[model samples]
Target: MTGGPSRGARGGRAWREGHAAEWIAALWLMLKGYRILGFRLKSRAGEIDILARRGRVLAVVEVKRRKTMQAALAALTPHQTARLVAAAQQVVRGRKALQALEIRLDLVALAPGRFPRHRRGVGA
Candidate 1:
């Protein structure tokens, strides 16, 4: 009789929602003509939600879900941004296919009842 909900309960809900948002973002990118190279790619730097490519550009996408577009866009901080960039570098280093592509950090912000807003070359 101390806390609101157990850690597992809260974490499970968040994990499920994050996964759903990432899938939605991936589909949206596909429709826009990008090929998804990976999802939930993890490196020692951090976790990249999605890795997509179009022509010579490789997009390292970070998905955010919030009540509003503004909130979602504001969710990532400078430190987090740095980590994302570092993660993207790590991802490219590990994938020979990504070697020749131009890597960019992108943001895909999703809110309820709204299409995902994509911001390319963010934190670059």
Candidate 2:
């Protein structure tokens, strides 16, 4: 059997798709009353896809572009989870007002042309 797309070709497509997904998700969040605080926030620990807020609620969201929920969930490796938690803590520590606000971890899994599957209040 012949190899399909080369590694570079596949990677380029995936990168483009991921950016598209992020833009779509960001727009969706804006429409849903969430104020976008940061996009692609990174620390030594890890990167947070999106950080948005609704009132006093601080949300750490992971945006996944996947064909299925299983595929999306699979992307959240244990190491990533740890880093997400650490980054969230760092965010909270920096702002006293935000620190008192209830923190929520969420997942937004996007499948092409479909409603994003949002899982809210995820814990470590």
Best by lDDT: 1
Question: lDDT of each structure?
Answer: 0.93, 0.81
C-alpha RMSD by candidate, in order: 1.5, 2.3
In angstroms, the error of model 2 at 51 is: 0.3
Over 1-124, each residue of candidate 1 has an lDDT whose tens digit, in order, gives 7669888899999999999999999999999999999998899999999999999999999999999999998888899899999998998898897899999889999999999999998886
lDDT of 2 by residue, 1-124 (tens): 3679988899999999988888788888888899888888877667788998998888898888888766875676666667888998887787776788777888778876578777777654
lDDT, model 1, position 14: 95
> Which residue pairs show collisions in model 1?
none
Q: Which candidate's TM-score is highest?
A: 1
**Clashing residue pairs for model 2:** none
Give the poorly placed runs of model 1, Cα more than 4 Å off: 2-5
Task: Assess candidate 1 and give its TM-score to the true structure.
Answer: 0.93
* TM-score of each predicted structure versus truth: 0.93, 0.83
